[model samples]
Target: MINAYATLASLVAFAQDRLKNEEKGATAVEYGLMVGLIAVVIIGVVATLGGQLAELFASVSEELPAVTTTTTTGG
Candidate 1:
């Protein structure tokens, strides 16, 4: 029973050591951060462009001439 306990403990310790010494999870974390940064930048660009485009379209709408009517008399 004592030998079995020691073996189990050793296996657990080995697993913990491997997990602690590993760099495998760091790459995934780095990639996630990069993706988040890119999303923020995209959102900022869209907000700026959307505001400018709305202003431009509003100006264009105002410049369009309204319909008119005229009458002429012949003698």
Candidate 2:
């Protein structure tokens, strides 16, 4: 029982040391989280404005008059 307890204590200490020393994976995870947050913000802005923009363009197009052109040939 004593040996088992000692092994568990060492294992816990080793895990704590490893966690404190590790940085490479943490940086990659942080970068991924930042990118995900930016993407969510962009999607939200676009979704909110998309309908308004489409309506504005539709109104503008309705206000514009169409133009027709004819060509004449000289003999």
TM agreement with the true structure for every prediction: 0.36, 0.42
lDDT of 2 by residue, 3-75 (tens): 5456546655655675689743345655565566567667767898999999999987776543212222322
- Superposed Cα deviation of residue 49, candidate 2 (Å): 1.4
Off by over 4 Å in 1: 1-26, 54-75
The stretch of ten residues in a row with the least summed lDDT in candidate 2 is 66-75
Q: Candidate 2, clashing residue pairs?
A: none
How many steric clashes between backbone atoms does each model show? 0, 0
> Among all windows of ten consecutive residues in candidate 1, which has the lowest summed lDDT?
66-75
Please, what's the RMSD in Å of model 2?
A: 16.9
